[model samples]
Target chain A: MFWQQLVNGLTLGSTYSLVALGYTLIMGVLNIINMAHGEVFMFGAFVGLFLVNYLKVNIFVAMAGAMAASALLGILLEMLALRPLRRRAVSDLAPLISTIGVSIFLENLALKIFGPQSQAFPAGALSGVQLQLGPIRITLVQIVILGISFGLMFVLRFWLSKTRVGKAIRTTAESIETANLLGINTNKIILLTVALASALGGIAGVLVGLSINAVEPTMGLSMGLKGLAVLILGGMGNITGAMLGGLILGIAEVFTVAYGASSYRDAVAFGIIILILFIRPQGLFGKRQGGRF
Target chain B: MDIILNQYYLQIVIFVLVNAILGVSIYMTLSTGQLSLGNAGFMSIGAYTCAILTVKAGFPVYLAIPIGGAAASFISLIIGYPALRLTGIYLAIATLGFGEVVRVIILNLKITNGALGISGIPTLGTKISKMLSSFGLSRFGGLTAQQTSNLLVLVVLIFILAFLVFFCTRLNRSRVGRAFASIKADESAAEAMGINTTYYKLLAFALGAFIAGMAGGLSAHLTFFIGPKDFAYHRTVEILSFAVLGGSDLIIGPIVGALLLTMLPELLRSASEYRLMIYGALMVIMMAFRPQGLISKETVRFWKRKLGRRINQ
Candidate 1:
């Protein structure tokens, strides 16, 4: 039972890591929480669903299409909600609130278009092959989810480290003013960061939709919050921290459900977070410093 | 049209008052430079406590409501000290978690009826009227029971709103208020200026929780049923929008925000299907154009100057 739960936890955790990576990337470069990120993820899932269910496209094509759509959405959100605020020198909280507005708009738009119901992926969307390994059961879907999540993370790490644009993004994250002084276009970098982060968010949504076999309008709300928690757990802005934190949270939740009463499962993630916050406000991996205030 | 006596309008007014109270609660914490997304948790605590007391413990609405506020305030004190230590996004996320935990606990608790919620809660006016009549006082004796109850709720809500608005305006000018302002302007500078930032922040947090609790107690009686869903995460955002849309800088801002926002959907009922979509878009445009909100100090100042010049001319 424990081993089976562990595998389930790892599968769930990898998706969380994907979401957290989106959050951490945006936070690294912009120092703002894209409140619309969850909606972006939700939109990605819907796009992927449309491609697969309506057009009969394969999952890979659906994912690529979803990524492209969500990347556009990310750019739009930055342009419409974020850039104006940044240009106006508004309070730090303004962007957060504006993104919240964007989130609400997107959510309602989705509700209006999709209706307030969960839409399921077609049966046989993936081959239903369960692999039993001596008392622990695994499924083909779970394996695929895990594989895609790890693959994306690997690609992200490589792209952020090896490429020149990757170095530019890092420089921008380190210090925007410095990056600009060094002749890097900070605006373009910000746009790229948002697009990349949003694309990752979109892909995570598709993975979750695939695993759950259904997607809905409100899926982003709770998942987005959990991603926020994961971002905090991983030491906000630290990519590695988000990755490890997601796995820890996923395992903790799965174990809680398996051993403890299932009712306490949701509470356990937050309860552990509160305890951690009391002990380490900077998060487990975050560096200790005075708050931005 | 008899707007005041119209049931729909009266209900909207009552809701506006309740939401205004909640918005002010948020403004209280925001005033001290703390962004709390957990007022909904405080509100739920108050709602459940008030409901349980009134339904099971046989407490009167007046007494039970205060106790509810006290209960939420007490919980805030327990969490505020440690939670307030973290600033900005950290504090917001911690409070968000706190709200989720509160919701889950309420969902699991038998006293809360475990998601079925508690229904048939006696109206605040009926209970108060009965209690007063028993004491040989007949404040609402002339009207029908429904009208009496509606009027009583309105009067009581207005009374509380007046007290809160007065209190908030006063607080805006008091020593603690100045401390709050200074902290918001620059926390490190405020600390350097010998202000006890921790004590003040906790005070603001607890006070905000207290107000949110009171609003919850009052709202519990307004609606026939009280459930965990009433105080979900989205409610927090809604309350925040009230402050954000109205302007958190002035005492009148949130109240104005509440009134307008409460009435917005009603006005948009013609396009009911697109109500939330429009509301959301408005928030984005409002933030984009006037991120300081609709009624900042500058807005008041600008109006004051214009009015003063026109009067002189």
Candidate 2:
């Protein structure tokens, strides 16, 4: 039972890590939480849903379509909501509220287009294969989910460390003014980072949709909150922290569902976030002392 | 007066007043520079407390309201110390989490009636209709029971808003209010100048919760039912928007913002589904153009000067 839950936890955590990376990426460069990121994830799932339903594409092709679509959305989100605020130099909270506007708009738009039902995720060939390894049962979809998530994380880490634009993004995140002085195109970097993060969110959304076999408009709300908690838990703006945080949150949630009531799943996740905020606001990998949440 | 006090119209006016009270509750916290998005949690505390008192414990409405407010304020006081330790967006996220926790707990609880929610509870509207009938005002015969009930709710809501306006103004003008403004300017600077930052923040948080609690108590009595779904995070967003869209700088900002925002959807009834989309767009546009909200410091000062000059005249 423990091993099975662990497997489940790891799988769940992998998806959360994808969403958390989006949040971490935006926070690293923009210094603001993109509250609409969950919607971007939701929109990505719908894109995949449409692709699978009409175009008869495989999961990988659908994922690519979702990534491309969501990247455009990320660029649009930066151009419309965030860039204008950056231009004006509004208060820090203004962008948070602005993203909330975009979130609401995107959510309502999805509701209008998709209606309020939970649509079936086209799992394609992955649905019928459950692989049993000794005492534990794992599925091909779960393996794919983990493999893709880890693969993407590996690529992201490598890109951030090695690529020229990656260095520029890292420098920008360190200090926008310093990056500007270094002659980097700060606006392009911001847009590029947002798009990359949103694409990750899209991928996470599709992976989660496949794992659960359900996709809905409101899927983003809870996932968004959980991803946020993971971001904070791992330490804001820290990629490795977000990964560890996602794993920890996933394990915690699975244990709660196993030991406690199923309804307490969301509460447990949120409760952990609050407890972390009180006890160690900086989180595990954060640079500051205990009280700087 | 007959046309104005009709049931539908009175219901709208009553909600306007209730939302205005909710606006002030959030405005209190926003004025202190803590953008707490958890007033809905406090509201739920008040609603459930008041409902249990009146429904199960058999307490009178007048006695229940203050007790409900006290319960919520006490909870806020306890939660604020640790929660207020976080700064900026972290604090907001913490408060938002608290609001959701309250909802989930209420959703699972037995006394709150779980997802089905508590119903058939008596309301202030019922009392008002009784009072109207006993006074023979129903002899005028044009006022239906619904209208009479709605009128009572309107009266109660107006009283609540009036008291809140007075209390908020007094609180904002006192030494505490100055400290609040200073904190808003810079917390470390305010701390260096000998202001107790934690105490003032807790005070603002508790006061905001207390006002929200009071509004919740009244809303429970007016609406005649309370549900867990009623106090979710979106409600907090709506309450926050009253402060954000109206102007967080002045006392009247949230009140006027609440009034206009509440009425805007009603006026644009032709495109009901699109109203929220428009509202969301408007928020983005407002944040882009005028983050100070519809009312700013200059607008408030200009009005104050104009009113002061008129008084002098």
Candidate 3:
């Protein structure tokens, strides 16, 4: 039972970590919380669903297409909403509110376009293939999810450490002004970061949608809140922290639900967040920046 | 037409007044650079307290209302001190979590009647009371189903709203208000300048919650119903939208925003399905074009500039 729950927790945790990676990356580099990110993720799932159902595309191709489309949407959101706001010397609240507006707009648009009912992706391809290991049963899809999530994380870690663009991203995350002085195109880097983060969100959404087998316009809210919690737990703007946070949250929730009431799952997660905040507001792996609240 | 006059218009007026109160309540903390996303939760506390007191405990309406507001205010006072230490987004998240916790508690509590919702509370919507207050007759007794009475109640609420605006405007100019402004500008700087940042922050939250509680009390009395759904996340978002869209920095902004947005959905009832969509789009456009809000002092200044040029010509 413990092993089963652990595997379940890890699978769910891996997906959350993927989404948190996107959040942390954008937050780290741009110092902006992309509030519409969850919507972007939802849109990615829709795109993937459309590709699979309408175009008869393979799952891998569908996922790639969703990621690409969502990346474009992120760029568009940045150029149109964020870029203009940045130029205006507006308050931080302005962008946050605007992104919330954008998020609402997209959610309602999705509802209008796709109807209010929950939509299910074709489950035959992903389901009905369970892997058994001594009273612990897992699905083939779960294995794939874990594999892809870890593979992406490894790739990201490597890219951040090695590549020129990666180094630029790191520098920008550290200090945008300093990165600009060092001859990096800060704007381009920001756009690139948004694109990369959004793509990751998109892919994660598709994976999660596949695992859950259902997607809806309102799914973004709960997912977004959880992702934010994970981000907070892992330490804001810390990639590795996000991963660890997601894992902790997922495992904690699974164990709590297994031992306690199912209804208290959300409460348990948020309670943990409050406790963490009380103990260490900087988060588990977050570095404290020198900014007055 | 008689039915419409007796019911629909009366309900509309009451809703506007209640929402206006809610808007202003939200604006109080917003103006102080604090964002408490738990207004709806506080409102729920007030509503449930009033409803239960009136229905179950057999309290008079007037006494029950204040008790309801006081109950919510008390909760705010208890939580505000510890929660106020967090700033900006952190504060928002904390309050939001508080709201969820409140909802979950309400969902589980037996007195809340669970999801079935409390019913059969006495109705507070007589037309004569509304009419008398509308005509500036302040001291009239509560009216019956007469049209004039409904108008009176409406006018009285409006007067109450006006007084609140006046009081808030005055408070904004006071030393305590300046302390709030300083904290908003820079908490450490405010602290450095000998401002009790902690006291002022808690005050802002508690005051906001108090007003929201009052609004909720009024809402419960007017509608004669109280339920958990009335103070959901959507309502919180709506209140936040009113403050943001109207301009959180100004006293009149939330009022204008609340009135306009509240009336907007009514006007767009034919497009009910697209209501949220349009609202969202408008918010995005407003944020993009007018981040300071519609009734912001800057917007007023810009309008004055245009008018001044026209007059000069």
| lDDT (CA) per prediction | 0.88, 0.87, 0.80
Compare candidates 1 and 3 on DockQ and give the better one.
Answer: 1
Q: Comparing to the true complex, what docking class would candidate 2 get?
A: medium
For all candidates, the clash counts are 1, 0, 22
Writing each residue's lDDT as its tens digit, candidate 3 over B1-313 gives 5665575678677778878888888888887788788899899898888888888999876677778878888898877777777777666766776776777677768998976667767645453344345777644344334555466567768877888888888888999889988987788999999999889888878778878887887787776567777887667877878887788878788888888887887887877666666666666677778877788778788899999999999
Query: What DockQ number belongs to candidate 2?
Result: 0.77
Best by DockQ: 2
**TM per candidate:** 0.97, 0.96, 0.91
- For A41-93, candidate 2 gives per-residue lDDT tens digits of 99999999888899888878999999999999999999999999988767789
| lDDT agreement of model 3 with the native | 0.80
Model 2 chain A worst lDDT window (10 residues): A284-293
DockQ, model 1, C-alpha based = 0.69
lDDT of 3 at A169: 91
Ranking by lDDT: 1, 2, 3
Q: Give RMSD (Å) of candidate 2 vs. truth.
A: 2.3
What does candidate 1's lDDT look like per residue over B1-313, in tens digits?
3445787777788888999999899999999878899999999999999999999999888899999999999999999999999888778889989999999999999989989999989988787678667888655435666666677789999999999999998998999999999999999999999999999999999999999998999999889799999999878888888888898998799889888888888787877667656667877888889877899999899999999999999
Kindly list the per-residue Cα lDDT of model 3 for residues A1-293, writing each as its tens digit. 99999999999899889888888888888777777888888998889889988898888898999999999999988887688787777766666667777787788899889887888788654666987899999998899889988999989989988999999998988888899899999999999999998899889888988888888887776677677778778887888898888888888878888887676676665675656666677788877772211
